[model samples]
Target: MSIAVQDLEAQVLGLPPEDRARLLERLIASFEPRSKAQEAWMQLALRRQEDVRSGKAAMVPGR
Candidate 1:
């Protein structure tokens, strides 16, 4: 990786857990959608993520 990217990575890695998670969400949002269908799926997944994070949903273990 280039020096600038390396430096940025180091800085991001140094962030606290909550700050890193916030940055991660922003990074994921910055990606261009591949298609409308895929974008809709991603939006659903993000909502589910929020539900779990907010204690409105629970994850089930696979059998």
Candidate 2:
């Protein structure tokens, strides 16, 4: 099941308020969990944040 995100976004934006709310509810429920690679990437992101907070890593400008 594939969708063009931009087209869907445009259609959703054009909907009436009540219909938009209903459609958004269905769309939210249809989303699945992150893949293994995504999970690994998220873990790395969290660890990097922890390292920065503990002064073990330096922040880069414009990040």
Candidate 1 local lDDT, residue 2:
57
lDDT of 1 by residue, 1-63 (tens): 457988999999999999999999888977954789988998999999999999999999999
Top candidate (lDDT) = 1
Candidate 1, residue 4: lDDT: 92
Candidate 1, RMSD to the unseen true structure: 5.2
Q: Which ten residues in a row have the lowest lDDT in candidate 1?
A: 25-34
In model 2, what is the error at residue 12, expressed in angstroms?
Answer: 17
List model 2 lDDT by residue over 1-63, tens digit each: 888999889988999999999997787757956689978988999999999999999998994
Cα distance off (Å), candidate 1, residue 42: 0.2
Question: What are the Cα lDDT values of the candidates?
Answer: 0.91, 0.89
